[model samples]
Target: MPLLCHNGRFADTLDPVLAGDNPSFKWGEGLFETMRMAAGEIPLMHLHWARLQQGLTRLGMNDAALQRSVLENILRELALRNECAAAGRLRLHLYREGAGLGFVAEAAPLAAADHGWNERGWSIEVFADARIAPDAYSSLKRANYLPYLLAARRAADTGVDECFLLNAQGNVCDAARGNVFVVRGGIVQTPPLSEGAIDGVLRRHLMSLLAAAGRPVQELGLTMEDLLEAEELFITNAVKGIRWVARFRQRTYAHAVCKELYGLLGQPFNNALVAP
Candidate 1:
């Protein structure tokens, strides 16, 4: 059986067993982080916590220290329980506690962690019907994922691996599940956070690595035309380090830059299998 941790407490099951009602479910008042666990430890956890702190602050939730402590303990215990000491995925979910149809009294925040053993190179196309709304909450991985869900459905139905979601301004913001990057003329460019892309942990780390290696990377505007002309395209997420896109509709991409960057990323961790 999979083990789960609910608000610092371990349990044999994953159900929340809420005391009252879950405001996260009734409304979309929740944020989450999906992290990659390597050798029982979460790499780049500090960044994940930093982003989580931002979400908590944005959602008007206090007790950051307590929440971090709870997650830390749960991660350790769950890692051991799941036998994921070598590798796994850790998901942290935080939500406001409330009741009734509308948000009632604001109580202490509730959180949970699902740690599991693991273990995609994706063919992606653009999703056009829905565009993400730019707002304070847009950068956070919140529970309000209707747009992403719809895009994923379209991808599955259309025989593609994933779809890129554009922002309200019709700029490429993110893929269905990760941040998008485009490479043209050996220079890498990704949509800025201003474009409503989530501040992905791997995205930040990979950018830093690229900069340190003296390779040029820019946070700039990206359009469908830019992608069409790019030599390479890729996506980054915490769980999957980096996946070079094989195809985007009629356009195809090469992995020359992705291979170099992927090798650079794996150097420190000794993870040769990260190449995709």
Candidate 2:
């Protein structure tokens, strides 16, 4: 059986892990981070940690036990317990605990570091049922994930790999499970955080990698029209890295840039260190 680390303790079952009245379960009052583990460590941990801290600060859920070193140790132990220490995906969830906060960390093994990069690209469409509104909480990866959940369901119902969500202004905000990017006129662009896109760790790192390689990405708001006119489209997340979009509506995209960017993501760079 897989073990989960809850408040630094191991539990084989979730029956006693959370109370029935837990705010996170009842009201979705919590935050979480999904991370990629490579060579028994998290390469982009710095960025993930930074985002977690920001979320905690934003939600006023600061707790002394939620220190970086402590959580890192918990995650490492969980990975080891699950026999995924070398390569895996890790998730750290923080929820309200007696007016303060508590955490649960879990890990799952992957075949390799590049396990889920869909080489043939993904087929996606725009989800028009709802609009994501830009807010102080929009960018945080919180437990109140109804919108993305519904979008994911829609993707399944429609037989599409993913769905693009638009902001209240009817502009492309992000994808159901990742950040959206477009390549147009040889310039890469993505919706800014101000437009309600999730502050994805991979998105931020990819922007840095591109800038370092003399291919800076523009943080601009994108529309369906802009997407239709683009040369290529791709989505990003920490675990999957990059997934090119093959078809969006009647438009088809190329993957040359996506391939190059994926290569860039695989290479080691500054601050892309193993979690300490």
Candidate 3:
């Protein structure tokens, strides 16, 4: 049986998530991280964990035991699986544990592209639906993914690859699964965190790379009209890495910038090492 972290130790029997009702499941009372576990080793785990801790603190449910136990179990599992002997993405989850409620870290998922079935190129729309970020939990990757999942489905049904959700303030913040970057005139721009975009791990990595390389990856407020003038558009996420947005509201362009960003991810996931 797969192991689970509970309170501060490992349980070998049925997962608590399967055994009881978790508020995270019903009320979305927990935060989670979608990790990139390669060969069982998650290179950027420290960064992922930092974000998790912050989210827990924000929710007033910080548990040092849960954190330590999760990390220990992940390392142990990696050793058992010999994941470091190979390379692939792994996702881990954590939920608050208690009576009538417990969070579960499900089995790892395959590392694959979820957006833009980019055969030759990818196409997406500037979906005009507005979803203002909930300030109380905007920063957490909590269990309430229904809104995002639903928006993505709407886009897919429309024959579009993905959706760019502008915040209620009417600025490009992020997509259903990733952050948005608008490139034009040799400048690469993404919405600032103030725009209410989730601080994605890959997004942070690319920002450091772009800044260090002198690539001019600016974070600023942007408008829909800006999409028309954008020379190139792309979305960045941990799983998809970087996908070029070929079409934005009848505007089309060559994805030169996406190719550049994709090159950053093709190399490795390093926190301190930033390169052009």
Point to the candidate with the largest lDDT: 2
Q: lDDT tens digits, residues 1-276, model 1?
A: 666776655666645445455777778777777876666567888889888778778877753434555566667668778776456667777776532111111111111111211113458988999998778788888878889889989999999878999998898999987899988888999998889898888888888888887875799879889999999888887776777887888877788778777777762232544321
Rank the models by TM-score, top first: 2, 1, 3
Lowest summed lDDT across 10 adjacent residues in model 2 is found at 267-276
The predicted structure with the larger TM-score, 2 or 3, is 2
After superposition, which runs of candidate 2 have C-alpha atoms over 4 Å from their true positions? 111-117, 267-276
Screening candidate 2 with a backbone cut-off below 3 angstroms (N, C-alpha, C), the clashing residue pairs are none
Q: Could you give candidate 3's per-residue lDDT for residues 60-132 as a string of tens digits? A: 7745645455564754464354323133444455566652224444333334343223435567775566575
Error of 1 at 265 (Å): 1.2
| Tens-digit per-residue lDDT, 103-123, candidate 2 | 888898753434645756799
On the 0 to 100 scale, the lDDT of residue 23 in model 3 is 65
Candidates arranged by lDDT, highest first = 2, 1, 3
True lDDT of residue 95, candidate 3: 64
Task: Give the clashing pairs for model 3.
Answer: 37-90, 39-83, 39-84, 40-83
